[model samples]
Structure formats: structure tokens, C-alpha cells
Target: MKAYILQKDSQSLDNLCLIERPDPVPGPGQLLVRMRAASINYRDQAIVTGGYFGGRVKRDTIPLSDGAGEVVAVGPGVSRFKVGDRVAGTFFLGWVDGPPVGRRTARGAPADGVLAELVVLDEIDAVALPPHLSFEEGACLPCAGLTAWHAVVEACRVRPGDTVLIQGTGGVSLFALQFARASGARVIGISSSDEKLERARRLGLETGINYRRTPEWGDEVQKLTGGRGVDHVIEVGGAGTLARSMQALAFGGRIALIGVLSGHQGDTNPHPLVMKGGSMHGVVVGNRAMFERMNRAIEINGIRPVIDRVFPFAEARAAYEYQQSGALFGKVVIAI
Candidate 1:
């Protein structure tokens, strides 16, 4: 088997390398997966370059939470999957249902990841892929896709006629755009690129706010919504944009604080939440139950994940480089 590892104690991509290793065998309640594809997340880059969870790579780690593969073998006591089933691993290995137990449960960072050509996962920690999606598309679901679903759909409770404001054109933002549109909400997408915003328009975006042009893009959002503000804000920009995201929300609206793209902590007026009676909920990628539920919606709505680029398995490092470039509009995938 071949896998990429972020070598122990080093966080720079300079330390990442590919090596051959013995193929892993599935133990009790596990499945041996022949990986078909994997997608890169911002957190993946953070882990590889020492930007995640205090910028420390504690050990050599396989580094992706989003991947899709075919089950080639199943160990004893596994009933959730069978040989040749197409599946993707959950972001949290042990979270099957309900609320999250802790952040330590995540994959890719502080745990062996799915960047390998072959891997073993507990059967319950993986979910069946949507029938219509290609393996590359399925690979985009576990982290970015699930987080968007958890934030916009489940946490914010988006509904028909409601307005949703999604920040940027990264994986989670694009997925939130699709899911919100599928739910009949009026979708407004924020991006720095006019070209990307136009592309988003073709993807069911009702309106586009170029943050560069309108620095207070949230105010622009208000103007677009006729001063009513938006019902939901898929807030992925952390402190740098949360204040604006807060200003963009309608009275009593909800903000799903999902990412720390602009660093984690900063000063902000609490008046936005206080004055509007709005709520901000911290979002982590969700559990298996949410993953399964999101898959059902993906299947029924015929939603296909927007993959910005695909690199061959041998070009895994380049894929990481592209993700770090901050130029990708959607998910960056590796075809294994």
C-alpha cells in the first residue's frame, strides 16, 4: 500500500512524503477499503503545514477526512457494509448519532487519515455513497459537505422562501449554496471573484456579493434582501467575518459559525446578537446519523458536489499545494 504522511514533529509540507507500507487488514467490526478518491479541506492543509490545532503535528499521520472507496473485505461482526459497497468515512470515527461528544473525535489531525490507497475503517464509521455521484464527488462529502448540511440545513433550519447568505466559494460554502437552494431558500453567495460568483449563479445562486467590491458585504446583503437581512448566515470566516455575518442576519436569524479561516479569536460587538435577538451556533462536522440523512437529501435532490480540480494519486502533494493556494472554488480531490 502507498500513503502520504506528515512526518512526526514537523508541520511543513517540506516534511510530507510518500512511502510504501504493508496493507492493513480489517479487524473485528471493520472493513478494508480500496480507496478511489479523496478531497482536501482547509483543515487538511492546516494539519500538513502545522496550522491546525495549535500548529503541531504530534506524529506521522495520514491526512484526509473526506474520501470514498469500495469495500474489498469485511471483518467479522460487520453488518453495515458488504464487499464492493461504495462508501466514505465519517469525519468523527466514533460518532454514530446525536450531538458531538468532543473535538478530539475528528480525523486527519491527531489521527491516522484516509490519504492512503487502501485503509481500514469501522463499518459503522462509514456511510453508503449517494448512488448518482461519482467516487470523486462522494469524496467531497464527509467534511465540507456534512459540515454545510449540519450548519445550514440542520442547525439553521432553512426553509422555503428563507434567505441564506454563504461566505466564500470554498467547499462548505458551495455545498451550503446547493443545499439551501434545494430546500427552496433564496440563496446569496459571497465571493471575492466575480467570475466565481457568476459560476455560482449558474449553480442556483439567487444573488452574488463580491466582498472585495463591497467590503461591508453584509450591508450589501441587506440591500439585496430589501433591508430585511437574511434568515441564515453560513458563517465560515471566523472572527474576521463573523461580525459582518452577524450584521447580515435577519432579526432572530441564525449563524452557523463553522470555520476559522480568518483566525479564531477577535473583538466584536455583541450588539448584533443582542439587538436582533439572533443566535450563533458553533458547528463542527457532524456525526453518522447526519451523514446518512444528508446522503438521502443528496440522492433525492440529485445534488452533485462541485469539484474544482482533480489530481492523480501520485500528485497528492500538488493537490495539497493547490488547496493551500486559496484559488480553488470548490473541493480539490485526489483520484487514487
Candidate 2:
């Protein structure tokens, strides 16, 4: 089997080397997956460049947290799936169904990820993919998709008549837009490009603000909503845009802090949220239970994940480069 591995001493795309390795066999309660596709996330970039919270890995590791494949074999006691079952691995291998356990291990950095032809996943940490989704689409679900679901559906509980402020057209935000729309929420999106904004409009975005042109998008939000402000915010910009996010919140609204795309250094105030009775929740990619629920929702709503491009597995490096190029409006996938 051929797999890409990141060396501990070399943490850059230039160093992501693909090599042949022996096929791995699953142990008790595990499934040996023949990965068909994998998706890149912002976190994967951070891991590749040694900027993730844990720093450089202590050992060579496969990269990418999100992937989908068919079960080639199932270990003893693996009742959750069988050979030929389609599945996707969870982000956190151990935190299955409860409040996060301490320092939970995750894929693509602290542990071996799915950037390989074959990988082993615990039965408890893998979820069945929706039958309607292709492997490339399933690869988009484990991270960006689940995180968006956790924010729009779980944290904010966006409902019909509510307004959701999506930050950008990246993987998570686009997924949030789709989920919020499916839940009957009015979705507003902000992007640096008018073209991206226009594209978002086709995805049920009720309004689109070119934040580069309208720097005070919060004011625009207020105007769009007739001074009521948005009921929910998918806050991916972190401290850089957090003040504006607070200004755009409706009374008793909620903000789910998902990423810090804008560097984390900025002066941010919390008073506006306080005044608006707004609450903020930090969103990490969700657990297995949430993944299952999200899959069901995708199936029920007939939601298909937006893929900006799909690369052959041999072009995984090109996939990473494209994801980092800031030209993508949705997920970047590698077809294994």
C-alpha cells in the first residue's frame, strides 16, 4: 500500500513523502478500511506546517483527519460494521459520546491520519456514510461538515425565521450555510470576493456581504435584518472579526467560535455581546454521536457536500497547495 507520511523533522508540504508500506490489519473491534477519498481542512495545513497546538509530531504520521472508505475487513467483535461497509473515521478517536475527555488524541497530527491507501479505525470511532454520498463527499463530512452541524444545529439550534451569519465560503462555513438553510434558517454570508458571495447566494444565502468592500459588515447585517441583527453567527474569524460579530448579534443570539482564520492577535471586546444578551460557544469538530446525527440529516435533507476540486491520490500535494491557495469555495478532496 502507498501512503503519505510526514517526518517529524520535516514539517512542510515539500516534505510530505509518499512511500509504499505493508497493508495494516485491524485488531479487535477495529476495521481495516480501504480509503477511497480524503479531504483537507485548515487544521491539516497547520499540522503540516508545524503550527498545530501540539507542535511537530514526535513520529512520522499520516496526514488528514477526514476520509471515507469501504471496510475491506473487520476485526473480531466489530459489530458496528462488516466487510464492504462504507464508513468515515471520527476526528477524535476516543471521545465518542460524552463531554470531551482530557487531552483527547486526534488524527493527522497527534496520531496517524487517513492519507493512506489503507488505515485501521476503531469500530466506535467510525460512522456509516449516507448512502447517497460518494466517497469524495463522505470525506468532507468528518471534520468540516460535523463542525458546522455542531454549530448551526447543536449549539445555536437555528430554526425557521432565525438568521445565521456565516463567515466565509470555506468548508465549514459552506456546510453551515447548507445545514442552516435545511433547518429553515435565513443565512447571510460574508466573503472577500463578490464572486464567492454570488456563488453563496445560489446556495440559499439570503444575503451576501463582501466584507472587503464593506468592512463594517456588522452594520450591513443590522441593515439587512432591519436593525434586529442575526440570531446566530458562525464565527470562524476569531478575534479579528469577533467585535463585529458581537455587533451583529441579535438579542439573546448565539455565536459559535469555530476557527481563527484571521491571526489570533487583535483587540476584541465582549461588552456588545453582554449588552445583547448574546452567548458564545467554542466549537471543535464533533464526536461520533454528532457525526451520526449529521449523516442522518444529510440523508434526510438530500444535502450534498460542495467540493471545489478533486485530485488523484498521487496529487495529494497539489490538493494541499490548492486548499492553501485561498481559491476554493468549498472542500478540496483527494480521490484515493
Candidate 3:
């Protein structure tokens, strides 16, 4: 098997070396998958740069958690999946059901991730990809898509006629827009680039605010809602934009804090939270059960994940670099 191995001392993409390794066998209740595609997430970049989750790396690691592949073999007692089944790897392998908290259920840390020719996943940790999605699209579903689904559908419980604000056009934000729109909710997208905002409009976003042009974008959000703030805000910018998100929320509005793309540290006054009686929920990526339910909705609604580009497996480093550029409107993938 050929795998990209990160050298211990080098925290650069140049340190990622494609090397030959012995093929791994499935353990009990595990399934061996021949990977077809893997997608990059913000976490993948942090891991590559040695800045994620307290910068922990016990061994040389293979990067990326979200991938889709065909099952090649199954270990004993793996009755749920058989050879030739097309499945997507679960981002949180330890979390099969219920809500996720802390770092206990995270995937792609010390564990070998999916940037390889083959991977062995616990049978219960993989979800069958929707028959309607391609391997590349399925690769995007596990992390970014599932996170948005969990926040909008499961956590916030956004309803029809509710107005939701999604910041930026990154993978999670774009998925949030698509999912919210499919649920019959109104969507407002915020972006720093007008070109990207136009692209988002083509994707069915009815309103867009260029944050760079409109420094007081929160006020615009309020205006769009006719003096009331939006019902929900997918706060991907975290602390850097938390105050603005606060200003853009209606009374009792919910903000799903999904990422810290903008620097992690900032101060926020408690008065708005108290006065508006709104809530902010920290969303980790979802569990296996949520991923399964999301897939069903995707198949039923015929929603397709927005893929910015696909890179060959050997160009995984280039793929990561492209994602870091912040010019992409959707997920970047590596075809394995």
C-alpha cells in the first residue's frame, strides 16, 4: 500500500512523503476499504501545520478523516458491511450515536486517517454513502456537510420561514445554506468577496452581504429581517465575528458556533446574550447516526455537495495549499 507519511520533525507539507507500507488487515468488526476519494477540512490543515488540538502527534500520521471507498474485505463479525459496499468513513469513529462533546470522540488525531490507498475502519464507524452521490461528493459529506446538518437540522431545529445567516462560502457554510434552503428556510450568506457572493447566489442564496464592503453587515442582516434579526446564524468565524453575529440575531435567536476560522481569541460582552435571551451552541462534527440520517435527507432531497476542485492523490499537498488560499467556494477533494 502507498501512504503519505508525515515526518515527525517536519511540520510542512514538503515533509509529506509517499512511501510503500505493508497493507493492513482488518481487525475484528472492521472493514478494509480501497479508498477512492478523500476531502480536506480546516482540521486537516491544522494537523499538517502542527497547531491542532494542543498540537498532539504521537506518531507519523496519515491525514484526512472524510473519505469514500469500496469495501474490499471484512473482519470477523462485520455483518453490517460486505465486500463491494461503497461507504464513507465516519469523522468521529468513537461516536456512533447521541451528542458529541470534548475531544474524546474525535477522529484523525493519532489514529491513521484516510489519505492512503487503503484504510481499515470499524464496521460501525462507516456509513453507506447515498446511492445518488459520487465517491467525490460522498467524501465531502462526513465532516463539513455533517457538521452543518447537525447544527441546522438537529441542534437548532431550523424551520420553514425561519431566516438563517451563514458566514462565508466555505464547505460547511455552503452546505448550511443548501440544507437550510431545502428545509424551506430563508438564507442570507455573508462573504468577503463579491465574486464568491455571486457564485453563492447562483447556488440559490437569495441575499448576500459582502463583509469587506459593508463593515456594518450585522445591521444589514437586521434590515433584511425588517428590524428583527435572523432566527439562526451559523457562526463559523467564531470569536472574531461573535459580536457581529450577536447583533444579527433575533430575540432568542440561536447561533451554532461551528468553527474558529477567524482567530480563536476575542472578548464578547455578556449583555447581548442576557438581553436577547439567545443561545450559542458549540458544535463539534456530528456522529455516525446523524451522518446516516443526513445521507437519507440528501438522497431524498437530491442535494449535491459543492466541490471546488479535485486533486489527484499524489497532489494532496497541492490540494491542502489550495484550501488554505481561502478562494474556494466549496470543499476541495483528493481523488485517491
Maximum-TM-score candidate: 2
> Model 1 scores what on Cα lDDT?
0.91
For model 1, name the residue pairs that clash: none
Error of 1 at 277 (Å): 0.9
Scored against the true structure, residue 309 in model 3 reaches a CA lDDT of 98
- Work out the TM-score per prediction: 0.98, 0.99, 0.97
lDDT of 1 at 226: 89
Residues 204-323, model 3: lDDT tens digits: 898999999998898999998898999999999988888999999999999999999887788888588778999988888888899999999999999999999999998888998999
Worst 10 residues of 1 by lDDT: 100-109
* TM-score computed on alpha carbons, candidate 2: 0.99
**Backbone clash count, each prediction separately:** 0, 0, 0
Which of the predicted structures, 1 or 2, would earn the higher lDDT when compared with the native? Answer: 2
Better of 2 and 3 by lDDT: 2
The 10-residue segment with the lowest total lDDT in model 3: 99-108
Clashing pairs in 3: none
